[model samples]
Structures are given as C-alpha cells and as structure tokens.
Target: MSSLSMDKIVELQAWKLKELLKWREYLGVLVEAVKEVFNDRVEVYVFGSAVNGRLTVSSDIDIAIVLSEVPKSGLERARLVDKIWSVMENKGVPWWYPFEIHLLRREELSLLREAKFTRLL
Candidate 1:
C-alpha cells in the first residue's frame, strides 16, 4: 500500500468510535423524556471529559440540558426537575454507564465556554 493511501485511510477513520456504547443509545431514549418537559424546546449536549477524544473506559458522560426558556421561579424549577427525573427513571436508562446531568437555561449559554460542548440536538 502506498504511504499516501495509508494517510488517507487514517484521516477517513479518525472520527470513528469503536465502542458499543449502550449509553449513546440510552441518550436517544432520554432525550424524549426531557423534551416532554420543554415541549420540543430542549437541546442536549455531550460534554466534559467523555467527548474530548481522550476518554478512558471509566470516563463519565456529562450531559448538558439546554432549555429554550427557563423556569420563572424556584418552585417551578423544582417541579420541572421532579418531572424530568421521574421520566428518566421510567425509561429504565441503564445506569450501567457513569454520567451526570447539567441543566441550563438558553440565555445562560452565553456565559459558557464554546469549546466545552458537543451539541447533540
């Protein structure tokens, strides 16, 4: 094989992730649950150490939830959290994979560093 061809192959295969991440599939399931809370105004992101191209097998998936509109009051936020958690539990999201959740209002995003997230919306 030519050296040039090998380089091309390497470039083409760079984005490929070989692991059978059940967590990724589970994310697909959980997105629906979160959407119910915001009525289609939510976005999900895979952030933190997990998606940084340097993840160890033990790295945790840091999920960031962005809502189009934030709750107006503390009580509303609590109720929304309760509902979202209930939905997550009902979905049987396999806890086998380590993860954490970070919720953010749409406007709050302006304060976050851009390189920190990989949008899954």
Candidate 2:
C-alpha cells in the first residue's frame, strides 16, 4: 500500500464519489460482495468523497468495514480483502477503483462517530 498525504487522500475521496455515481450498478455489486463475505459480522459503509458528491473520473472506492471482531492477523485481513476482490471480479464488475478497508470492533461506535468523514454508499 502507498502512503497518501492528507491532501491527496481528500482529493482521491472526491474522485471516488464521481466514479460511484458513474458506475452505481457496479458499486451495488461490490457492496453485495462485501455483505456476502462478512455476513452479519460486519457493517460496510461507503464513505469519504464518493458519498459527498465530489468525485472525478479517476476517483477510487473508499469502503470502510466495521467488523464485529478483529482478524487474528494482518494476513487474515488481507485474505478477506482478496476474497471480496475475487467475488467482484467473478461477477464481471470493474476493479479499477481502490478499496480502503477500515476494520472496527462492534464497540467502536463512538470512535466511528468522532471520525470526520461522510458516508456515501
């Protein structure tokens, strides 16, 4: 993963929103894949620029998944991410957009609320 500066992150967020609107159907498919992967163990949100209606043609997807339980290791998280990616690809959905997975425990509602961001999807 590449490190993104605050400004770059903000810009990317806005661009992602544009792409979401342009490809709403594909976004739905991605969301469905997330649901299938995590089941009731997590809540997936479409956050950042895409939700705020400030996206551009090059925006990437920023998805935040609040998990009921944290994975045992980073590898587990990576595997889950790969599974979601695979499902989207199998469905013939575009994978051009990047994903930002934000894992949170069920008890972290307060933290999530304190975070400054928008939920678009």
Candidate 3:
C-alpha cells in the first residue's frame, strides 16, 4: 500500500477535525448510510475545502466515492445518489444545499494517475 508522510497525515487529520466540528452529526449519519448501502463495494472520502481546512458554513460538502465498477447506466448511479440524498433530507440534515458527489471507478486511469502522483510526490 502507498503511505503518506506523517506531515501529510497530520494535515489531513487536522482538516478532518475541523470539518467534523461543523458537520459531525450529519456526516456521521451519512457515513453510516453509505456503509449500509454500499457495503464493501465503495469507499468514501472527503475532499476540497473541507479536506484543506478552508471550509465555511456556506461551503457545500464535497464527497468522493470510489466504486469497484462504474454502473453501466447513469440512471443506476443517479438512483443511488438520489437514495442517499433522500435519506439525508429525511433525516433533517440540511438538504437542498449545494453539494457535490464525485464517483470514480477503482480501475480508472485518472485514479491510477492520482495514485502515482501521490506516491511520487
């Protein structure tokens, strides 16, 4: 497995701490929901401003989900997204806000490139 330097890990931890303070409850629920739905098929990460410690109350959540495979149809993925969104909304966790869900395939070239970049840099 690739390893990140202590400095980078510390930076990432600090960023996550700050984000947790803002959206702890919501995120906890979201994480649980994701785990329940995707099981072992997906991995989730927080990125963008939240990952960089530059988040504001107005800043929307940026979640990156890596899946073992890209669904053959966009509708399939959209359904998953909608299910998550509905759950979040029903849980009263601030729906109708701007947020981004980035889905990536585990075997995609872009993902491979990012892994290489992280390992090399």
Candidate whose TM-score is highest: 2
Error of 1 at 74 (Å): 5.3
lDDT of 2 by residue, 19-97 (tens): 5566556667777778878767566666556666666656655667777787879898889888888898888766665
The local distance difference test score of model 1 is 0.68
Q: RMSD for all candidates, in order, please.
A: 10.1, 7.7, 12.6
Models ranked on TM-score: 2, 3, 1
Q: Lowest summed lDDT over 10 consecutive residues: which window, candidate 3? A: 112-121
**Model 3: residues with Cα > 4 Å off, grouped in runs:** 1-21, 56-58, 108-121
Q: TM-scores of the models, in the given order? A: 0.61, 0.65, 0.62
Clashes of each: 0, 7, 0
Off by over 4 Å in 1: 1-21, 56-59, 72-78, 94-98
In the predicted model 1, the residue pairs found to clash are: none
lDDT per prediction?
0.68, 0.68, 0.63
Looking at model 1, how many pairs of residues clash? 0
Local accuracy of candidate 1 as per-residue lDDT tens digits, 5-80: 9998776445233332455677766677778766756788877776666665555678778886766787877787
Q: In model 2, which regions exceed 4 Å deviation? A: 1-23, 109-121
lDDT, candidate 3, 25-83, per-residue tens: 56666766676667666766666665566666457667767778768888998988877
Worst lDDT run of 10 residues, candidate 1, spans: 12-21
